[model samples]
Target: MSDSKAARARPIIVFDFDGVIADSHDVCAAACRWAAAELGHSDMPEKPFAELEAVTYEALAATISVDPERFAGLVCGALEARTTCAPIFFGVADIMMELSRDFDIAILSASDSDLINDFLITHGIWHLVKCVMGRDVPGSKTEKLLALKSAHDGKFVAMIGDGVSDVAAALHADVRAVGVAWGWQSARRLRASGADAIAMVPADLLDLIVVQELTEAPTR
Candidate 1:
């Protein structure tokens, strides 16, 4: 088979790191609060910090009045130390492994790829993922999705995330976006953000992918 045909046969599933794969809400919240304090900003509300799981570090930094790069460095530094503390969600590993059998799985997230790589490596499923595109990738999630769309021209690409930003990016990129209910933002928010579907649980995500595959298969 030609390389192009092989690529077409395997669609890509891009996952968000925090909330979706790793239960890193606490780590993110801590990092945001720490960054705010370090920047001498007393207006960082706990609510926005919790919502930080759903936003890019640049957006969060702008809200707190700090340089984006510096804010990311501070947060990433804080996250690096708590890497071992964030646990992978229940059944996520099994679901990822199951998806890897048919799809080329990758990660596209706001968190640093190196940080996420460490977590994936420690969890022993690093080999299952094809690539990691994080904040270091030099664009918003929308731009990154557009790049992936261009790279995988003929194949279907889906972004699985727990945030509105994820859904919006996928929509803008013309890719499918699946929002997980267990993540930071509410399902209503994801839907409002135009998510194609919402997975109520980890197993539900796998089921959604399988259903989509069957539905999209060419009729012979």
Candidate 2:
């Protein structure tokens, strides 16, 4: 294929690192609990994973009457340690490798950039990604998506995540939003959050991407 054609054929996929790629739900919950206690919010009621995943880190901290920045630090520290032990979900590496062959993969996550990078490197898939916009990054995921859209003008973009914020960002950026059921939010919650589609498993995600590529392919 010609260079232009090849570029046109490839889609840009942005992923949320935590719940989408890594099975970090428990790690996140533990971190939240720790932060709550350490920050003197131990009396705060425990929230369901779906509810927690739906809110921004700042909002979650605010709900528990804790300082967002300090809570974020605690969570980040705990998450980094947990991920160092075991990060990537089962079969994620293989699927990421396959997707990288036909897509320009990127990461837009609320997790710390260093932690995300460490997890990706540990799993040997860091090289597969083209960009990573983390919480430490300068802007929100919506802003990051807009910048990516401007850079990759006319190319199809999609965001795969397990959070309501991901879907909201995708909507704000006018891109495809795909939710994963195996992550932090349940499929029902993801659906209610306005995700375009939900993948029940890793293979299902691959199939969803294929279908989206075909559906969005430009007419000759």
Candidate 3:
């Protein structure tokens, strides 16, 4: 890229949903089990998450002679609420508060858009975020981040998440890559990606995000 083009791609942050935003594994797993139970899938294990990865609402309902459509709606309704109701990782609130002072903050998540928005809105951080990188309402994660770059004027952009897909975006998006450990993937997995930086905790993120705007409130 030319120096002139490089100047336009600024440093900004993107986040992952689920584990990064809130510890939603339990909530999501429980919701799935509850939905399965409602469908009379007696075969479902008592474990909240053991079968969650394999059991979609449609599949569970089919197994129990229930209407998939109706059960899906029920699952969505119940789980969406849980999106905003989970526990925030320790020190995340403080780190977000501090980081917001410097960097251009945004949500670049692989999770569903409504889920991400709900989590942010419930926690009152929705207003703090200027943009969101949600997976396809009708598009992919790559599309969302590209759009985010198009909308900003910063010289650097960052893909911050706990997955390989996020690494792909960092490569495809032509920006620096970052990994966070408070999410689904392991730190070992992230480090293996050869990312630019790996944040073991949200508080560690402060060191990378703060540039020269410590005293200046980030552009809202």
Candidate 4:
């Protein structure tokens, strides 16, 4: 096989769904509010989206005083209902398609797999993705990352996400954690999370991957 073929056969770029791919904060926040109200916390004060986006998904559920597992189910159902309507960030499809040429793309999201799969399919970008590992998978992101690493063997795995949890999970799984500036969290927040690198925009992400090639040693 040529060098390009070998490169394409290895190295996976994983993405987080809601914030990273789909701009679904409002929808997710609405779901959270509805679930909180269902649990009799309707009076919960609203926080700024930026404030809410700063934290991890688990922390968000706890802040709303909803049982985590129940909140997850409620949010999943809400997202499923909104799957066809939620919009991904502009130019993301182009970037994904470009990267798909040299690297296998995958999603390692906190959202439900079926919902994400449907969303990708609805947007006509499902073929660019190699796999979807969502909350339905029986483990944390760290465990899922580990599974991906093991499954791909010698492939270099990189997790691209918008939250600190993603950085932590990727590092824990012994993979590279790349942050996106256009997602739920700010670039500063991602930097603080010890991300291997941060992409300022969808286009910058493509440059980062193709130019840097993510060949440096991963942070311990």
lDDT order of candidates, top first: 1, 4, 2, 3
Model 1 pairs in collision: none
What does candidate 1 score in Cα RMSD to the true structure? 3.5
Encode model 2's per-residue lDDT on 38-63: one tens digit a residue. 98877644443567644556777877
- For this target, which candidate reaches the highest lDDT against the unseen true structure? 1
Error of 3 at 7 (Å): 11
| Deviation from native of the Cα of residue 110 in model 2, angstroms | 0.5
Please provide, for model 3 over 16-56, each residue's C-alpha lDDT reduced to its tens digit, 9 standing for 90 to 100: 66667677767765666677677666455443322222223
Q: What digit string (tens of lDDT, one per residue) describes model 4 on residues 56-132? A: 44566777666877866776777677625689899899999999887788898877788888888889999999989
Ranking by TM-score: 4, 1, 2, 3
Looking at candidate 4, what is the lDDT of residue 60?
68
lDDT of 1 by residue, 133-178 (tens): 9878898788887776556553655789888888877777777888
Error of 3 at 161 (Å): 0.6
> How many residue pairs clash per model?
0, 0, 9, 0
Per-prediction TM-score to the true structure, in the order listed = 0.87, 0.87, 0.69, 0.87
Worst 10 residues of 1 by lDDT: 211-220
Q: What is the C-alpha RMSD of each candidate to the true structure, in Å?
A: 3.5, 3.7, 7.0, 3.5
